[model samples]
Target: MSIKALVAHGSTNGSTAQIAERIGEVLREHGLDTEVRPAAQVGDVAPYDVVVIGGAVYAGRWHRDARRFARRNADQLSRKAVWLFSSGPLDASAAQRSIPPVAGARRAMAHLDAVEHRTFGGCLREGAKGRIARSLITSGRGGDFRDFDSVTAWAERIATQSLGARAEPERGDLRT
Candidate 1:
């Protein structure tokens, strides 16, 4: 059977979505069939063999929708090969720096045997639709900082490892 991968992300200004697409591209290049979808659109995680969950971060926290999705699917996710990523910290400096997830999320993720979890820099658009988005963007905090190469490399690694694990047969051969 062909390996299947699901790339789900949450975005406010489209940066996280772009990152998700980039990840999907790399996975496809690595020979895995990938489906890139929004977090809200993901109906079920059980159908996918490999699940990549990512979202944009604001004010040191992931999008509420994304967090909710993770929480709702925690059980199913724990049973499968799962990976998590966050797009935050605009600019190269932020890209290199490490920012821990919010206390609540950290606690929630403690039990998950996640294959990998990463934090990547993301982008911010100039205009904000409301007070919160505008404040975060204008607070001298938001800008495009995503490292496409790094994102692609990580996706490649996941694809390689996931596919490799599936390729191995469960039982050894006994020759006559």
Candidate 2:
């Protein structure tokens, strides 16, 4: 059976959503069935064998939609193979070194027993929806800071791990 994966994200101005989509693409390339969707739009987590949740960070907190999704699906998520990611650093720090998850992400990780978590650089561009985003763009502080190579590397690693796990036969199926 093919492993079904879900890449659900909470994004403000679409950069994080694009990252989620990239992750889904990578997983699909590795032969896992993958779907990308907004966290708010996912009503249940039971259909997927693997779940990857990502959120945009603002002021050191995860986006509200991601937090709520984690809370609502806590029980189901804890039973599945789960991963989490955050995108918020406007600089190159994420690519230089591992950026720890924000407090909310940490809490969710503990609550859901997520297998891994990654942090990636954020993007801010012209016409972003918020006043701060607009001001940042005007001040030349906004640009596409996302590291897509990093995103692809992380997703590939996940595919390998998931595929290896699926290759192991279940105890019940290992009859002598």
Write the residue-wise lDDT of candidate 1 on 1-176 in tens digits.
Answer: 77788988888778889999999998889888899999888888877778787878777788776787788788877777777788877667646676666543464366456766788887877884557767877888766788888888888888888877777777221100
lDDT of 2 by residue, 117-176 (tens): 999999998789988778878998887779999999999999988888887777221111
Candidate 1 stretches with Cα past 4 Å from truth are 171-176
State TM-scores per candidate: 0.86, 0.95
Assess candidate 2 and give its TM-score to the true structure.
0.95
Q: What is the Cα-based lDDT of residue 118 in candidate 1? A: 81
lDDT of each: 0.77, 0.90
Native RMSD of candidate 2 (Å): 3.2
